[model samples]
Target: MFEKSYDVAVCGGGIAGAAAAIASARQGKKTVFIEKTVMSGGLATTGLIYIYLPLCDGYGTQVLFGIAEELLLASLKYGPGNIPNWRIGKNAEEAKRYRIIFSPASFTLAIDELLVNAGVDIWYDTLICGAQVENGRLTAVEVENKSGRGRINAKCFVDATGDADVAHFAGLDCPTAQNALAFWVLEHAKGAKWRLEGSIESVSMHADGGSIDKKRGMSGIDGAEVTKFILDGRAKYLARLKKEYASGNQSRTTLFPLTLPSMAQFRTTRHIPALYKLRDGEDWKHFDDSIGMTADWRKSGFVWEIPYRSMVPVGLKNLVAAGRCTAAEEDAWEVTRVIPTAALTGEAAGTAAALCADKGISPDELPVTVLQDALRKAGNKIHLEDVGLAPKK
Candidate 1:
C-alpha cells in the first residue's frame, strides 16, 4: 500500500537482515528490511531452525555479540532451570566451540522488538523480483507483493535475501553451486512413551509428558525434550536424518516425524564466487579475518573470521551480501548457518551500507576501520589476536 525508500535497504528479515537493519537504524540511518514470510525471525521462526548456533569461540568468548548476544540472552530467560550454554572457546588465543541455543518463538519476538525499538522499517510476505541499476551501482530494487509490483530506492543495499536473490538480479554473478541444498521444516509430535535413565541417557522425552502424537500433541510437551535430543544426539541424528530423509516417514504430526524444524533447513548451495570465497584449504586452518567462530561437536575445530570482503560483492559497488548466502564452502555451511554468526555478519553488512550513506562512498571503499569500529561499538566480537593470519598449530 505504501511506496517509499530509505538510506539503506536490506532484503531478508531473517536474523541477519534484522541485525543489519537494527544496526543501521540505531546509527540514525533510515533502513528497511524485507522478508518473504511473516514473523520476521527467518530460519529461527518460520523455518523452525531454533538453535542459534556457534555464538562464541572456544576460548569462552562470544566472537559474535552485539545484537547476537542480546537476542540469545533474552530468549534464554524463558527456560527456567534448563537454558543452553553460551560459553565456548578457551580464550582469545585459540578458537573454541560455540554454546548457544534459542527457542523459535523467543527469538522471533526478541529481534522484532529490537527492530521496532530501533525504528527500522520492515515488510513481510514480500519478494524482491528485480533491481534498478544505473551504469553499475544499484539505484533501486523492484519488489512484488500480493497487491502488485513496485520499487524501493536506497543509498545502498544489503542482499540478506539468503539465496542472494537481490544481488543476482542486479547483474551480480551469483553462481548457485551444487555442493549444498536447503529446506524448510515443520515438526509434529506423537507417543511420548520414551524414557532415558541415569545410564546411557539421563534425560527422558516421555518422563513427565504424554505421547508425541496428535493424540498427545495437546499435552504439555514443551521444547525441553527437543533441546536435549539436539544437544546430546546432534551428530547421531544428523546422520540419521540425512540417511533417512527420503524414507523417514511417520506423520509430520508424530513425535518422531516432527523431530526437525517445520521442514528440514538448508543454508548454502555450494561454491559461490564473491569478491572472496571460503576455499577448502589448510591455510585457513587459522583464519586472519576471524570475526566469529564455531566448533563441530568438539571434534574437528574451526574458527572463521567474518571478512569485510564477504559482505561486499567485489564488482557491485552498492550491493552487499549476508547470512547463509555469504561466501562459504559447502562443508562450511554448518558454521555460518547458525543465527548468531549470520546475524553478526548481518550487523557488519548493515554497518557497511550505512557507512556508504554517511561517507558518500561506494560500499567497496567504505572505511573498513570505521565499519569495524561501529560494529565493535555495537558489541560484536572481532578477533584481534588472529590479526597475523597464521595457520593454526
Candidate 2:
C-alpha cells in the first residue's frame, strides 16, 4: 500500500530489462527497474545460460553495438570470453562466431554493478501483477513486494520480462509457442578440460550438463504446468546422476550441481503481438522504423533489422517490450529470443521509453526519425547496409 512515480519504469531485471533501465537512466530520466528475482541477467545468470551469443554478422564485422556490445565486453570482467578479431573471415562453425561463454554468477554481479553505476532504481523480489490503463495508455503497474501491494506510476514502461508479462496483463493477444524440454545446470567438474581448440580459456568453462526430452513438450503458461516442467527436468537430471554414479565412475561421484536455472530454460513461451511481426525470410529487409540490426547466431551472413514498431504492442500507448517477449513470429523467435537480441531490443525500448516520457507523447506517435537518430547516436547500426551488408532481392 504505497505509491511511487518514475519517468520510465522497466519491468523484468533480465538482460533486456537491465539494458533498458540503463539506457533510460543514462538519459537523466527517473527510471526504475523491477525484477521478480533477486538477481539480474535473467536467463543469462539465473537460468545458468553461460553464453553471450554474438554481436557480429558471420562476415567479419560487428552488426550489433551500443549496450549489446558493452554488456558482452562487460561479461569478460569476471568470466572468460573474447572479442572477435575484425580481421577474421567468415566463420562457418558456431565456435568461431563472435560470441563468449560467461560464468552465470559472475554475470549477475556484473549486471548489478552496471545498473547501480547507471543510477537506476532497482527493486528486486518485486512481481508485476497487473497494469493500470486509461484512454489507451498505460498509467502504472501494480506490483507486490515484501512491503506490500502497490503501484509504480510511470509516464512510460518497458516490458522486458521475457514473457511479456506486462503486455499480457494489459490485455494484448500475446502468443505462446511450444518449448522443448532442456535443462542447463552449473556444476563443478574437477579438472575438466572445457575449451575447444582456438577458444578463449576463460569463456570455455561451464558445468557438465545434458538436455532431456519429454514425450510431451512444455508449454509454460499455467502455474501447474510450469511446476510440472521443473519437477520433470529435475527428475531427469537426478536419474542421470544416479546412473552415472552407479556405473562406478569415480569422476561421476565427484560431480555436483552448483545451481539449477532459477527460471525455466524454455527458450520461447510467449511474445506480444507487435505493430510489426518479424518472420523468417525477411532477412536484411529494411524498415522505416528500424531501431537496430541483429544477426542470426545459428548461421552465417544472415541479418535482420529490428523495427521499433516490433517493440510497441499494437494499440498500447507509452509501453514497449524487449527480450524474448518482443514481437516476433514463432520462426523469428529463434533469433529474437537470445542474449544479443534481448539486449538490442532492450536498449531500443528503454531509449524510446525515456524519449516518449520526456516529450510527453505516446510511443506509437513518436517519430521514427527521432528515434533512429537517437539510436544512431548511441552507435547502433539501424540497417544492414550500415554494416556493409546488402539486402537480398
Candidate 3:
C-alpha cells in the first residue's frame, strides 16, 4: 500500500483546491494538492470560463477577495474585461477593456505556475476513492492513479471538491437535491459569429453552441456575456413575478452583443441544493458570524456578508467546503457557485484550514472572527463599507 502524508491535504485541483493548497502552504503548512486530472483549474481553468461572473456583488461591491481574486485577474488578464454591462451587449465598455479571452490551456498553466511557486506538492492524474477516518479524525484519503490504489495522509484536510465528495463520503451533513443540472464544460473549438443587429458592442452571442448565460433581460442578446445579463435579468423578472404572486409567463427574450474575442463560452446550471442555506430572511438578518458575501438575480440584488458558520460543515471537523457547495439554499447556491465567489470561498476555506493547522486546533474550534480579521489584514477586502454591492454592469 503506497503511503504518503502531508501536513494538510487538499482534494480537488480546481480553483478552490488550488487556492486552498496554496494558502495553507503559504502559511507554512506542508500541503499537498491531489487532482484527478492532469490539468488543474477545474472549471475556470479547465472549464475555459474566461470571464469572472459577479466578482463584485451587486452595486459594484467586491465581497470576496484574496488569492482567489488574484487568480481570477491572472486568468482574465489574458482576455478582455467582462462586457461593459453585467447584462449582455449592455456593457459595451467591458467588452472593449479586455482582449483575446485566453484559452483553458493557458489558464491551466497559470494555476500550475501559481501553485508550484507557492511550494505546493501537487499530485496529478490521481483520483480519491474514499476516506479513512479514525477516532473522529481523517487519517488519510484513499486514491487511485496510474500507479494504483494507495493512501495519502494529512493532519488537516480541505475538501475543495465542489461536489463535496469527501464530506459526503465521510458521512457529513450536506445539502442534496436530485434534479440539479450538471454544469457541462464544453469545448469552444468552433469560432463564434454572434448575431448583433443593433448593439453598442461589436460582438454578439452565437445562436448555436456555447453555454455562458447572458444578463440581458429585454431579449435579443446574442452575446454570451450579454445574454447572461439577459438570463439573470430574466431570472430576476421571474423572481419578481413570483414575489408579487403574479404569473411568470414570459413570451420571449432577445440576445445582446457578444463578449470579446468572438468565441463561444458557457458554464453553469440550476437546481443545486445546499446543506446550510443562507437565506435573506430572519436567518440572515440575525447572522452574527459573517464569512463572505454574494449576489444573484433576486429580490436581494445586493450582496450580503456570508457567515463563517456557513463555510464550516455541520459534522466535519478537519474539513471545510470551499466552492458552490459551501452552503447556501438553491437560489444562493446558483450565485455563490460563480467563478470568482467559488475561488474566493476556496481561498477563505484554505486560509481558515491553514490557520487551524498552525494553531493545532480543529476548524470548528478556530476563532472565525480572527480568521476574517486576518483576511482583511492580508490586503483582502472583507467589508461592505468600502466595496459597495451593486450590479457589476
Candidate 4:
C-alpha cells in the first residue's frame, strides 16, 4: 500500500473536516484533508444544502465565533446573503442570530480557497475504507482511491467524516441512527431572486412533491441501501418535473435543476461513544472543559457549551470526532449536527490535534485550559457565562 504521513489528518471534506484541517494547518501543522467526493463543502455544496445556520444565541446576542463565524461570512463572499454590521447597529435585530443563505457552488469555491491558503494538502476523491489503531491510539487510516489501497499516517487524526467513518473503521463502539428520507435540489428560477426563508422556512421545503417513509432499519451503512435511497429521491424529483411540464406551467419549465446533491443528505448515521454525551435539556450547563458554545437553532434561548470530552472518543487516544458524529443524545444531536456546530467542533478538534501533536501527547491528555486559551484568543466564546446566555424562559 502507498503510505504518507502528516502532523494532522482530517477525514472528510465537509464543513467540519475543512475547518479542522484549516485550523491545524494555520497552527503550522502539516495537515491533510481527505474527502470521498471530488469537491469541497460536502453537504453545503455537493448536497445543495444552502442554509448556513445561525451563529448567535437566538435572543439578542452572537455566541459562536472563530471559524464558525468566519466560514458563515465566507459563504456569502461569492453569493447572495446578508451579515448585519453589529458594530454600527445596522440591522442589529438580524445580527442577534446572524444566519445566511448562500449558493452551494459559491460555497464550494470559498472552502477550496480557504484550504489552499491555509497550506493544507487536500486529497479529494478519496474514501477512508479502513483505519489502524495500535494500543488504543490511531496510527493510520486506510483509504481507497485511484491509487488503490493506501495508508495515511498522522500523529493526530480528526474524524470529521460526518458519520464518524474513521472511528467506526477503527473498531470503536459507535452509536448509529437512521434519518428520515429528505432530498434537496438546486433549481434556477429565471425571474425569481433568492431569499432567506427565515428560521422556519430555512429548514422546510416548498417544492411540490411527496416523500417515501423510511423502511425499517434502512440505515445508509449498507451500500445497497444507500444506492436505493439516492435513486428513489432522484426518481421522485424527476416525476415532479414531468408533472409540471404536462401542466403547461411555463414558469416551472424555466426552473431547471442546477445540480443534485452528490452525497446523500442523511443527517446522522454513526457516532463515536465519547467520554461525555451531550444530552437533551443540558442547555446552558457548564463544562469545565468547555471549548466552545452553540445555540439551539430551532428555538430561541437555549445554549449549550461543547465539552472537550464529547469530542474525545471513549477508547481512542490520538483521534477526535468533530462533526455530527460527535457524542450527543437524540435531542442534543439536532443542535450539534448543524453547519455552525460542525465548524465550531471542527475548529476545536483540529486545534486540539495540533497541540497534541506538537507536545507529543494524546488528545485526552492535553490540558483543556491550554486549548481553551487558544480558542478564546481565536475569537471563540467558550462558556455561557462568557456569552451571558441562559436557558429559555
Residue range 1-393, candidate 2, lDDT tens digits:
899999999999999999999999988899999999999999888888887887877778788999999898888787655655544857655657788777778788889999999999999999999999898889999999999999999999999998888988888878887776777776654444554224433323444343457444766877888888788778887886787678765345366675788898777777888888888777778787888888888888888888888888887888989998987875577788899999999999899999999999988889989888888998888887887777773
lDDT of 2: 0.83
TM-score against native, each model = 0.74, 0.94, 0.71, 0.90
lDDT for each residue of candidate 3 in 1-393, tens digit (9 for 90 to 100): 699978888998888798888888888888999998787887665544544555443333345567756776576444333333433322223233212243455567778888999999989989888988786766788999988999998877888776677876676655543321112222221223432223234233232223222332222213354455434534543443354344333211222222222211223321112325665332223244565555442322455566667677665567777775677665555566666677777777788888887887767888878887877766576645436422231
Indicate the worst ten consecutive residues by lDDT in candidate 4. 201-210
**Candidate 3: regions farther than 4 A off:** 77-102, 179-276, 280-287, 297-301, 386-393
Off by over 4 Å in 2: 84-86, 190-211, 214-216, 250-253
Candidate 2 matches the true fold with a TM-score of 0.94
Off by over 4 Å in 4: 84-96, 190-217, 250-252, 390-393
Angstrom error at residue 377, model 3: 2.2
Between candidates 1 and 2, name the one with more favorable lDDT.
2
Give the lDDT of residue 298 in candidate 4.
76
TM-score leaderboard ranking: 2, 4, 1, 3
